[model samples]
Target: MRLTIERGALLKALGHVQNVVERRNTIPILSNVLIEAHDGSVTFAATDLDIEIIDGAEADVERAGAITVPAHLLYEIVRKLPDGAQVRLDLSSDDPRVTVTAGRGRFNLPVLAAGDFPAMSSGTFDTRFSLERSALARLIDRTRFAISTEETRYYLNGVYLHSATGDSGLALRAVATDGHRLALADHPQPEGTTPVSGVIIPRKTVQELRRLLEDAGEEVEIAVSEAKIQFSFGRTTLTSKLIDGTFPDYTRVIPKGNSRVMTVRNDEFSRAVDRVATMAAERSRSIKLTVGDSKVVLAVNSPETGAATEEVEADYKSETIEIGFNAKYLLDISSQIGTGEARFEFADAASPTLVRDGNDPNALFVLMPLRV
Candidate 1:
């Protein structure tokens, strides 16, 4: 195997694939990236069984061949090289050692036979759709924080993504909840359906895809199958196995008939919660919301940690009511509100309250109250 690839290009390809390699592996080949030099391009493929990523870049191909080498070490070598240096790699012998050379620095790293590398099954997706990278990023960032870490409910470990018929017809919706809090984010358009059922996008895929979507504004081609899903952008394609479980009916848990409404500036409300909650005990740091005719007060009190309260000028016209909620949960939900203002609709301290960003009547978020 022989190829000369630019130092920067090789490093960028390795950067995306290296993360899929496990730090500790029972199968040594699993720690290595399969490097294939064919035609006029080179490709790097790495996998952890559950997820696999393939990245291809243009390179000067001399002798077409393939080999497996330590992913992290190769990444480090190319990353440290001077800019514009050509990275020359060659493997000419049966018992191969990859020779890497760049200017004054050169090294030979032991290689594994490419035959031992694991292969990921290409999923047969029944339904496939395309979406803007920005749209997917927004959907993930808004709801991922609520994905449950509980092992017992294996289904909740990933975000539930599906097409729902909302007030404005079909919409792409994503939801996550760890019991204490829930996040629901959706986009009004760019939604379709197929025979294959909804799939739970694992947490790791969510994070990796987010990193990839950062520099992309183009539409991402997504293909989904019964057992796996694929996301393709530019020269990279990520394939991941779907978690096997059924997500609970989240909509049924959302409360209705919450008529008491309060409106406040998003930034001001978040700051007030942070300030008051600082003095509350860690075990039960619940913030009590007191609503009146035209004002709202946030109070947090812990006999051991002392008490703090801050008031925000709000637009409210409901019976004076007090409701308690986990301060941290409130802060998380508030942070994702994209608008300058947030609306909270409350029935009482015992009912779940709906929160929405600004006056977007299409999207609604519900949070179950806590006992302070």
Candidate 2:
């Protein structure tokens, strides 16, 4: 098999697919990328048995054939080649190696039989739909910070993606939590989407999908079955196995009747929290908020470390309330509010606090208070 591909194009395709190959492998074939040449294009594929990515790019195919090569090695060689140089790849038995040649450089790499690679099942999807890339990105960015990293509660490791009838109407919602804080966001459900059982997208899949959607303006085609989910965009396709656990009922975690309300500038609140947290204990990271009389003061005190206090102007008209919260949690929730303003609704000092963007009702956050 022989082919010539522009270095830039080859590097881009490899970058998209090679990340799935783990640096350490128990199986030899799993460490290599399956490269197939046919028609006028070359396809690169890599997988970790759980998730797979395939990317195709246009190339000059002299002899159509396939081979497997170390994904990371090929990527590095192509990436280091001169900018617009054309990369020539030849698989010949005389040398018993795959030859990669560019401007003034040439390297020989060992190859594996493509037949040894495991095949990813193209399972029948019970539901398929199309969504705007920007919309999907919004849903993920808003809630991913709250996804639990704890492995024991496998159910909480991914975002809960499903269809729901929100106050605004039918919507596609994403929710994630780690028992300390919860994030919930909704987008308009795409047309002709049939309701299916909720699927918990593992955290790793969310991150990769997010990267794929970056700077993408085209609509993304999605297919979901009971066991797997697939995303197709441009010349790339990603398939991932769904977490085989049930997501807990998240609606119960969101407070329904938190009456006390406080409105503050998002940036101001974040800055105040950051300053007060400087003196907070490294382990606890707790900061106290004193709310009253159209103003709120943030304070943190540690026995061995010292204390910090900062005041910020706010529009708090409800009964004075004091609450304790983890500084990092406050910053995470505040950073998500796109609008310059943020609203906090509280039931009391001991209950969960609801945080929302003053301009966007479709997204909100619920954070449990810390004992201070």
Candidate 3:
């Protein structure tokens, strides 16, 4: 393809799609990106068979054509080019080599057969909705830490999204659990859009897309079918096949009847947990909590190692209770609280604990207790 594009624009476009391409591939075409120039615009697409990303950028196309070229090499070359420089690309032969020239630099990169590249199927998705990337970002940020890495329980390996009657009438909820703890966050649904059908989005897609949308506040269109899902943003699109297994029922694990309430500064509690947990041996990074009338004691003891205790005065008048939690889990929830006060609800030492910001019933968190 022959096209002239701004270096910044091309790099930004490639940055979005090239990440979907793997560094190493068993098949030749899988390691390349399909570049198409047409109607004064250029598009780049890459995939690893499971996930695909397509990005389009404005350019000057002298001759409309398509070719497949090494994605990483192109990214590096375009990245190193002078800022604001314009780039011109043209095909050198039917063998698919591409001649790239910009300012005072010129190089021909070996290419693969564009015909060999796997095409992304545009399947009909049943559920369609548009959500603010910011809201989705909050949901993802709040729950991603709890995602399970254990491969055997594939069902719990991603975030569970579904329709729920939350504090707000109809809500979009995201939940992640690794058996030790669970992170749940809820937000109001947009007008005319029903709640998202209960589905488990794989961890890889969740994480990759989360990083992409961090600074993005635009509205994102989402389409979900029986076995696949698609995300459409400004000039980029992501399509992935959903995980095949079922996600375990998460509602049952949430402790609803916890009556004893504890309110603490999010930063303070997280700091105490982090400091005390350090003294815990690697095997058991456990932090024990002793709740009293007006004080809370954070303590950790490793038999082979030393012990640590921190007294953080709390506004608690409930019955005295001792509970144990994985320090990592507590730290995760507290960090996400971000500039807000957090509350903990407990029924007993053996029951799960419900945590959230003060009076913000919509955003909730649950942590299962650890026996110390």
Return the TM-score for candidate 3, rounded to 2 decimals.
Answer: 0.95
- Higher-ranked by lDDT: 2 or 3: 2
Rank list by lDDT: 2, 3, 1
Put down candidate 3 lDDT per residue, 96-193, tens digits, no spaces.
Answer: 57899998899899987778889979789888998899888888988889999999999888888887888768888889999988888888877798
Ranking by TM-score: 2, 3, 1
**Candidate 2 regions off by >4 Å?**
none
The per-model lDDT (C-alpha) reads 0.85, 0.91, 0.86
TM-score top scorer: 2
Clashing residue pairs found in predicted model 2: none
TM-scores of the candidates are 0.94, 0.98, 0.95
Return the lDDT, model 1, position 310: 88
- Residue-level error in angstroms, candidate 2, position 326: 0.9
Error of 2 at 300 (Å): 0.5
Model 2, range 1-372, lDDT digits (tens) per residue? 999999999998999889889999989899999999998999999999989999899999999989999999999999888899999999986767899999879899999999898868977999999888888899999999999999999999999999998878889899999999999999977877886458999898899889878735589888999999998998989899999998988888789899889999999899889888999999989999999989999999899799889999999888888899999999999899854799999998889999999888999999999989
lDDT of 1 by residue, 156-188 (tens): 988888877777777788888887677787676
The worst-scoring run of ten residues by lDDT in candidate 3 lies at 208-217
